[model samples]
Target chain A: MSWLIDPFADFVFMQRALLGCIAISLGATPVGVFLLLRRMSLTGDAMAHAILPGAAVGYLVAGLNLGAMTIGGVVAGLIVAVLTGAVARFTALREDASLAAFYLISLALGVLLVSLKGSNVDLMHVLFGTVLALDDAALTLLCAITTFTLVALAMVFRPLVLECADPRFLASVSRWSGPVHFLFLGLVVLNLVAGFQALGTLMAVGIMILPAAAARFWANSIGGMLAVAATVVAVSSVAGLLASFHAGLPSGPAIILAAGTLYLLSLAFGPSGSLAARYWPRAHLEA
Target chain B: MALRIRDLTLGYDRHPAVHHLDLDLAPGSLTAVVGPNGAGKSTLLKGLTGELAPLEGCIDRGVARLAYLPQLSEVDRSFPIAVGAFVAMGLWHRVGAFGRVGGQDAARVAEALAAVGLTGFDKRPISALSGGQVQRVMFARLLLQDADLILLDEPFTALDIKTAADLLAVVQRWHGQGRTVLAVLHDIEAVRRHFPETLLLAREKVAHGATDTVLTAENLFRARQMSEAFDDTANVCVRPATRGAA
Candidate 1:
């Protein structure tokens, strides 16, 4: 217990890091739930990598200011989402093909922009995050994004879930399917951008999606799945933060590693259709 | 309580699947649209429910709320949702875009499950259910919508006989309550016995009126020929008169 509490007392930066982790995870996990359910986890991945160009451009124009960079990231993310959707809907191109094409283009553009600006190190910090250097402003921005995302998610939870489940039915009942889809996708984009500091583009979606997928291993209902996911994300973020602080490792990658561990444990030991289920004496009966 | 359609034309892209068709859906009646494959039976219902845009006509009494159920095959039911949560989607349009579901939503969902004879199965995951059970789940969803205009497309194509009868019984109850139901069916006997009104289509309105008038030999043969022309495997709809008939 003393060792656990030591990090909190010895370093102000550690406390800030922990708080930042909480904020990023909170904003991301619910969005992750919808993403996994809608089979848009891949889209989340593409968008996360897709934000590189926008953030690079923002850094070139305005340095590492939080507000300016977030706007730039969101604009770029939305553009990728819209373009991918249009290619799929209007043309013969498949969704995966469009996503891949857009992802590579945006990534190359980001690389080109970063080269032009001569900030390769800064670009690394932006991509992988520099959570050890987190300050009060970064914490505040994280908190604000988490709160806004949570509030918006709470309001549109039902429709979003339904739309993911059966869009045709939504179309039959209401004329607002298009708006609902865009709103849900927009929230996802916002949360991913907000989470970039703590989890990085490569691992942010993993933190967002894997824990929720793990939660589904235990819960049978939507409400239960959501609650379980929130708990998992909260626990993993704290665990990851503590581990990083003790070992003097990067917090973002450490947090994602912790999340990945939880996913494995859920897969191994969860009751219904898990790895443990296979080894039970009466497992054959379940089948 | 009449759903009137005037010069309703429907299609995908710029091409027309249904053209210049007029229909009056009677209140408190079960109307079945039966025809050959590609005969626009499903397309017609899609136009009415506003899922597919109409190229030409207008729907009278357009303000009425609508509910729709597609064929069991049409939906990807492998999604991880519970029987109760599935039914609760009916209230989605009612909840408003930014609203949270509360006690009222729960009550309506419970009521829908009970109405469809799935009272105790509310918490069961949808993936655990049989095909027939999924169809009932959809009916439960329709009950929660409480929309005056209900449209179903080939809802009984894959269910067992007992399950199909049970679901049709639910539809009969809805009809008795003075709600409008438009169901697409391939089984003519079920249509004749369950629905009083019938619309026969072969890329157009081949026959539209009471079941007895439209279920004649000539119309059935014409519908069959069209079915063969379009897709040979499409079920040929023929209504069997009661065993006590001439």
Candidate 2:
């Protein structure tokens, strides 16, 4: 019990880090669930990579200011999203092709920008994260983002579900689909930008996606998926932070690996999951 | 409310799928838009439902509220939703996006599920449902819509005969209620059986009027011919004879 409770109780930084991770999970996992439901998992990954240049530019301009980097990352990600959508819409290219093209170009630009301005230590920090070192400003930002995200998510949940379920049906019935879609995309960008503070761009997607993917193996409804995803994120974050402190491991990778491990375990052992469904009587389609 | 179309050319990617169509759907009118494959039935349906904008002309949707049921294939059955919740989505128009679904809304959802013969399936995830059951759930949603006009596209394409007949009864019930209904259907005999008015369409309108008058053997032959040679740029449609109001 001491081993479990000592790290959070003794260190204020650890407590803040734990809260930060939980906040990111609460916001990011639901967005992650929607991304998976819409078959846009790769799109999330692409957007993550695309945010690098913008954050790097922010670092060059302001030297790791959380607000600047967040705005830059969001702008970069939005540009990629919009450009991908536009190319797919106007040109003969499909969405996947357009996304791949735009993300690759943006990724290259990000690498170039970061290398040009930041040192190797700064580069490592940007690529990984500094969760255990969250100051007051960073914690406040994370909490505010989480609050907005949860409220916006509650507002959009129904329309967003309908949008994901059958966009054409929603379009026929009401004029709400397009706004709901842009807002959903906006939430994704916001979560990634906020997650960037603690998890870094590359690992933020892991925090967003892995828990949601694991939850799918366990839950039967969207609301259940969201709840289960948040739980998985909480467990993963706490376990990963404790392991990092005790075993002298990297915090970001440890958290993601913890999530990945849970995903594998759920895949095998979840009651209605793939492996269990295979060995048992029920079909996986019930999920 | 009536739906009026004038010289509507609707399509995708600059190619006109439905070219130069003029039509009128009076308030409370029930008409079937029937045609062969690639005959622009879906394009026209999409245009009427306001899903597709006219590429060349205009449509006056006299009603602000309408409902549309796309083909079953258009919906993702893999979504993790229950039959009851899916039907409840139709109540969004009344309850709003963030509004709570109270006992009244829940009762309506139950009545709709019961109407479609899906009683006591409130919590069953939709992915486990059969194709016909999924179609029924779509009908249940449509029932909850309570719109002034309804547009259905290929509603019975893959459904079994029983499911088709049962769902068609809902269409008849809507007609009985004096709500306008426009459906894009493939079964010609079924169209003649139930729909009082029919519009036989090729890339162009072949005939439009009473089901018995429009679905003639010659008009059916012309429709099939137009579908076969649809890409011919030199194609000039020459109606054998103009049916009334065509």
Best by lDDT: 2
Write candidate 1's Cα lDDT for A138-241 as tens digits.
Answer: 78888998899888888776667768778877666666667777777787778878877666667778778988888877876677777888888878887888
Q: How big is the positional error of residue B98 in model 1, measured in Å on the Cα after superposition?
A: 5.3
Query: Could you tell me the lDDT of residue B2 within candidate 2?
Result: 80
lDDT of 1: 0.78
Model 1, which residues run further than 4 Å from truth? A89-95, A279-287, B13-15, B61-63, B72-76, B92-94, B97-108, B227-246
Q: What digit string (tens of lDDT, one per residue) describes model 2 on residues A1-287? A: 99899999999988999999998888889999999999988778888888999899999999978888878998998888888877887999998999899999999999999999868999888888899888888888888888998899888888899888888777766778878877877788888888878988889999888998998989889989998898899999999999999999999999999999999999988866569777875643653
Candidate 2 deviant stretches above 4 angstroms: A282-287, B12-16, B232-246
lDDT of 2: 0.86
Top candidate (TM-score)? 2
TM-scores of the models, in the order given: 0.89, 0.93
Candidates 1 onward: DockQ, in order: 0.41, 0.71
Model 1 pairs whose backbones collide: none
Which residue pairs collide, candidate 2?
none
